[model samples]
Target: MVVSVKRDLYGNGRLVKASDLSLGPRQCMPSSQSTATSVIFQQGLQDCGNTLQMTSDWLIYSTNLTYSPTPSRNSPIIRTNSAVILIRCYYLRHGNVSSNAIKPTWIPFSSTISVEERLSFSLKLMNDDWSAPQTSTVFTLGDIFHIEASVDTTNHVPMKIFVDSCVATLSPDATSSPRYEIITQNGCLLDGKQEDSSSAFRSPRPTPDRLQFTVDAFRFVGSDNSMIYITCNLRAVAENQVPDPMNKACSFSKSTNLWTAMEGTSGICSCCDSMTCATAGQSRRFGSLYPGHSRIGKREADPVKHWLLLQEHKVTTLGPLLVISTEQSQARTVTPLSSLVQLWVVVAFVSLSLVILTIFGIVGKRPFKLHCRKAGLK
Candidate 1:
């Protein structure tokens, strides 16, 4: 019985094909030998017209695998293992154009995929405008374009895409003159709560109900220096679902490029002459706890009284007007009256005690002792 066999063949015997040992869907016996693996890739390219004349491409790669092997003495094998790979690529187009003159644009495009094939695709330009037949196209100043790309993750597999670099070239164009002024406007409400609402000042949490406004003004100038003015009117309505009798209006202006509220005639002119303005004012008037008096106890008598005063003084000439009404209840001081009553009570009790002590003292001092004596002893 001295017949020695190969240690690997002692447990099992099998043959495996290299092509069958993939990371895909397949299984094998201990000695049969099997493995599975797959890879996916994606890429994007872009080309812009005169503003951005160049070609760029990026890459993304991913892979996964699983393998199992039988243990053997002569050819020892591990149990099981899995592996994965991920990669990303980025390409930028470069040319001899100046940096200032290049205005690049990026647009995304979609890709097609097949079920059996590993996910892989490229974004190509549909029009020849992005690429030149002979040399790469050149972009000129003040030009705009689009770029496109797509992912075949249609297979519903977890995958990642990366953007490497984006480049563009620019060159001067006689006919490529700049035009159109850029104008931006923003509005906001502040119902005793939040402030600005623009992305520049957004909070993760919900803000108090308020209106916000912002404006950006731009214009192209040829030779002569000039000034431009912009005007805007803003109004706010309470969404509380309750009927409100108050009027809420906000008027704003920018002079010397500064934002300010509009008041009367003079203030109106200031805002009307500015290039940018934000008109924001509150309409909901708050009533005072006290009817006739201001919240601070100032004697305005009533809203009519305050209005009359405003009219007489012509305070509206100032920029932006804010009118508020508040009422405060009257409070009387009772400390003095209580102190007077206590002092009177203490005085009366002391006077009565002194009178009783005087009467007792007089009676105790009287020498009314009666003594009887015999005539003979005397």
Candidate 2:
């Protein structure tokens, strides 16, 4: 006996089936069908056409029959399942090329992966013919290149480009006095592990008269984690004029010895004051001439006569005469003794005369006597 069963597509379990067990001795014989009829019957059971024409509801069968209702080859699911989608990328390219032919080039996925995964990237695309960057380029995730700019502190109109550090040169508009110096807070010129003690920047020296100095700063990007700080000290020397009281000019005549003795004839002597005398000269021969002594002979003999009298007399008055007549000069002058000596001599002479007259009066005799000879009387 033969048996047949019916089951669901998944076939997790079997289902019962029914079939006839008894049969008559003779049954009508079946007729053989042509190949076209068989082919037509098969075609009617299973439909075949382009996937583009298929609708979502249409049942599909896989070649292996492992899956049913397979997605269409033209759908997004097929593109995702297979590696058919192409992604475009971009990046910077460096090389000499004609300006007109310049165009953006695509970057490979492998190269962009470093920037995308690490979340950090840098482009030194600007003209950098100078030194290296002061700080490290390493950055934590989410960090961004904030800004890039330049200022013409030097005030050069054409604008020269400097690399690595921000060049904070002395501006031409800056004040001429009180010279300015440039300083930096971040890294300085580096030579191996050592940093240069000198400033990384440049500015003019301090002015001559100004006591204080003006300082300027220029900062560059430093280590990714650190902030910049700058400070400077200014060394300056100022010029000043000190008054020389000793060399100050005196208002009195410098030529007269008596005047010099009396602190110059003006009677306004600096000797007693804070100032000191610097120069002196002798008075003219006729400086002390009497009304009738203006004669040329007297004038010519004045110096000799004055000298002889000063030597012979030893009197205070003669000292003034001698000092006034002679042409004696000095680079620096002090008070002369002639005036004091003369005053003492005058007092001595007056006292001596009074004593003589007193003596004569006490004796009751004349101070002077006149005698006449016998022959002159006859």
Candidate 3:
């Protein structure tokens, strides 16, 4: 069904324009690799932007990118009116080509920034077992938030990753002036600094390329909104290299009154307290990766590769994470006022029934006596 949408579908000399076309909230982009004579494409629109008019409960998915319907690659292609959308997004309920054959599942969502297939980073809220991605973002207080940040290195060199910094904010804008810093100063868990905090890096690291951690579930008490977004900076380095202050994972131990390293020497954790962790012998190959770009939405693909640069970084935000408070987690339908109103209604109904019965009994007795007197034999 999507054969026409393939990168090589169009014939030679067919008109096509340069595009940075992307899909989904994570902004999955099409490959734009090219040479003077030819181009290579790695990904394509999943459904050729085909419109899926769904019923019987489905989520409407739509995207607005200009599209032109043309004949298949086998035939001479002629362009029609370019549709305003590049790819119309929609939840696939049931389809022959869908990946979810055993069970009805929505299409897979990918949110990663690829720097020329060298590295791509993604942040996800995981389930307790950390086996699969959690579908529901809603979380209750006192629950441990299992978070993971990973990189897809493809067939590239072996690499190690660090959760240099992380923060939780009430809004999606991670850099928004007001933010809560959960981890900072390279790979230090700030919450671990507190004796009562359960926040720390997962021990016996899950994998060399992944950084897993936990945060105590919480909410912004003063804010009315229940949503919270977690943003983190992930840095990658060579696997064989020794961990440094800039590339280490460190958590403070309250019982021992000392800092412990998850993979390396705790000395690297010393700088965490002063927020002075620094990366040594590094240059600005791709310049600085700030908290703004390459975020969850504005991900960019840089095909250009650097020769000596062994380090790359990305910032990702996973969010709208609903943190349910104690009061909010209880059933929402039952409230004090509603309960009181129901009680009053029942009382009023019973009172009206008693009055009706009493009136009927008085009239009935009088009728019975008058009938007896008429009979005169009573």
TM-score: which candidate is best?
Answer: 3
Candidate 2 is scored at a TM of 0.11
- The alpha-carbon deviation from the true structure for residue 235 of candidate 1, after best TM-score superposition, in angstroms, is 32
Ten-residue stretch with the least lDDT total in model 1? 312-321
lDDT of 3 by residue, 253-359 (tens): 88887789898778777777676676331222223543343432332433123323457888776665767676765546458768989999999999999999999
How do all models score by TM-score?
0.13, 0.11, 0.52
**TM-score between candidate 1 and the true structure:** 0.13
The order of the candidates by lDDT, greatest first, is 3, 1, 2
Which structure is stronger by TM-score: 1 or 3? Answer: 3
Q: List the residue pairs that clash in candidate 2.
A: 185-229, 259-264
lDDT of all predictions: 0.25, 0.23, 0.64
Per-residue lDDT tens digits of candidate 2, residues 62-138? 11011112345566442111111111112233322336464446656533432233111121211122233213322
Off by over 4 Å in 1: 1-57, 65-78, 87-378
Question: How many residue-pair clashes does candidate 1 contain?
Answer: 38
Candidate 2: lDDT of 116? Answer: 30
